[model samples]
Target: MALSLSARLPSCSSSVFEKAHKLTTQPPILPFPSNLAACGCTLLPASMGVARRRRQVVGAVEEQHNQTSVLAPKQSPSYSSSKLVLVIGASGGVGQLVVASLLSRNIKTRLLLRDPSKAISLFGLQDENTLEVREGDTRNQNDLDPTIFDGVTHIICCTGTTAFPSKRWDGDNTPERVDWEGIRNLVLALPPTLERLVLVSSIGVTKYNVLPWSIMNLFGVLKFKKMGEDFVRSSVVPFTIIRAGRLTDGPYTSYDLNTLLKATAGKRRAVILSQGDKLVGEVSRLVVAEACIQALDLECTKRKIYEINSVEI
Candidate 1:
């Protein structure tokens, strides 16, 4: 399954996966970042493969986004009726997969996205009962109306942006805003009755100033992400943060339809979930997604934080 994630991540799409920063004053030699969140996974419709076709150009290359059109279409995911999951950033790599996985499980899901129309193209049309789309941006508190959270039992916030500057930041959606402001607003907007909020954060969030992570933190993504995690921890909402390593799976949005349908978790099927930020290797989007869903039901995961990575072994 490890191989499955890496194998799928090569389609060459950019990450709008958001990150954040917060320079602490205590015992500060360099800015000490906070606890974390990060990337996610891909699960095709449990019955069908899956569909999220978007054309994107990354690093001077335009991926063949429609190659999958020639292939057979995948079915929507299945989820449970007893639970309602509100998925923020439902259009991202991890977010897309999380939605796909939820659908496969037959769970009722509501997606909060900038463009509600993308839902049709990404996850495919669904019964209003199974999937609902709300138009909103996390950065704006005005967009997060209280009614949106009314029936939401749980939430999976996979929202994020690239660590460095990219087109995804066109709207001034920087880590400071998306990671910090966006998350803070979302956390505050969440109903006190919420059962769980699974936050996907990056691995380096806890050590943005240390070595390699510092490189990625040149943009303060790790630090800002830490701030976002802090908000969730401080909020009354019960939550779990899943920090992912340098992501290495297809932004599947960039791959040919054929590849997505055939893609499966490779050798890296087993997952390693450590409480401290000790694991520093890459993780599969699959593992990340699985961890998010699993945490929703695991009592021990409540109010806890973990870093997730997957391996071939």
Candidate 2:
């Protein structure tokens, strides 16, 4: 498989500078003294000299701007008003970032969370057309009503739990219940005309029974994740699966949408994208969240499975 490596840089508000051609002028060759002529040099008029100096300064500024543009993040075009994206697990790490980014782009967003009140605390109040929060849990098939997906063009599922049992497993939300059963229920509830479904899964699912992965899968997290992936593959809905490596960066659970929008990968901004289950290492949660959003519109990503990782650059 081909390797897709990308660098994520901080965005700048500076406008792009147009390339400026070098300004050249031939100074009139005037008569000179014998000693001056010996060097074969001609002096430019005082005004021309000043003009050249100004050009040099302008050229330097343009060069700096060009460099900044190369390092700046690409601004994504605003999505169409018709695009209503429903985000499952909207309060989770990657999910929150996805929601914040979609809102920033002015895309209509619908969030399904177990606690509807959390939406107000996280994203604040918004117009009904811009954001709609519904109360539901994927673990309960009854909550996967068709109306929850009405007018939703895209769905991003970021729900998942810890590999080892912990407080997250409270209320019987185990790997089998949340990862496998929850995803299965969600996919089944998707509409036939859905534009796309981006599922966030982990890297070691394919190798869960192997050595170190087996240790992490002792509680069957990886196994259930793979089961969820298979279910989506068999479904009629167009889908993309992003298997992220060990996730780094913040969950930012306490922060509001404004803070989540500003979250960065710090030094770990270079991304490694590949097919198969070959890539190993860590990826920033922000990178994973961005990938899920990007995949929604890229035709080439449809029905594809990608393994992602990141490195400090």
Candidate 3:
């Protein structure tokens, strides 16, 4: 009877089946194999086989459950609905545009700023169901609540001062305070596994310029930005640093798609001239937002930097 039971059990996927097959003993008798002619010793082989298959199916189900539970955390976003993005500095110039772009994509957004009232006024009536505004100061580590960033997959920071102390992008830029400490505090608070990060910084900060006027220019602006960039790059978190040249308040427009992507390859730089470049260009904002999402999706832009400039498409 046991021989009949072993022969009837369907094969399992792994080599464990070979061992099961090698066992010569009359496999342990099933408790309820009743139709086998009243006496266990006289049970029909067919009836015993059916009971064996039932047991096989039960064991298979349990094995599958264990495998799935072990693999759940390792699965990628391609297989899951778990996506959370935290856009810091949502109250600022570029941040507002970023927030709008995120909403347009129908993604739930969490904005962390020093004040929620300013953001509420800027964003107007938001879909209470998706938009969440959490008040937190990035510069103050104690003020940052990890719970606010709990499930965040991407962190986009457009948190630098728009103008230097002298009202220039480079003039009297406080790299130590806003760019250095502020960014350091924020990065320190982030989890090592937080994958995507996009930081909006100014181009031309590769050199030093103590002059009040020059300090607002890229040369001076770069120092502070470099500090922040260094912190982000050194951290375990993957980062994307975007150095934008000469921000203006110009109109929105699109660019040649291929040309835009091509620009990222070489260490090329373009001046965002006042004529066509403005901080409010709809195309630029859209492009930056799209690039950010693509970076997270492709997993190719990890730990890289790129620059954005205005040019004729």
Pairwise lDDT winner, candidates 1 and 3: 1
Give Cα-based local distance difference scores for all models: 0.64, 0.70, 0.49
Q: Model 3 off-target regions past 4 Å?
A: 1-81, 166-174, 209-220, 250-286
lDDT of 1 by residue, 55-121 (tens): 1111111232222221113443222368999999877777766776676567889999898888887
The C-alpha local distance difference test score for the whole of candidate 1 amounts to 0.64
Candidate ranking under TM-score, highest first, comes to 2, 1, 3
Question: Which stretches of candidate 1 lie above 4 Å from their native place?
Answer: 1-79, 254-263
Q: How does each model score on TM-score? A: 0.73, 0.76, 0.58
Per-model root-mean-square deviation over C-alphas: 13.2, 16.9, 24.0
Number of the top lDDT candidate: 2
lDDT of 2: 0.70
Tens-place lDDT digits, model 2, residues 1-313:
0111122112111100000011122211112222221111222222244446444334333323323111123354444567999999899888877887777668899999999999887877788889999999999999988999999999999999999989999998899999999999998888888999999999889999998899999999999999999999998889989889898884657456555645656544344565667666788887788778767776656787777765543
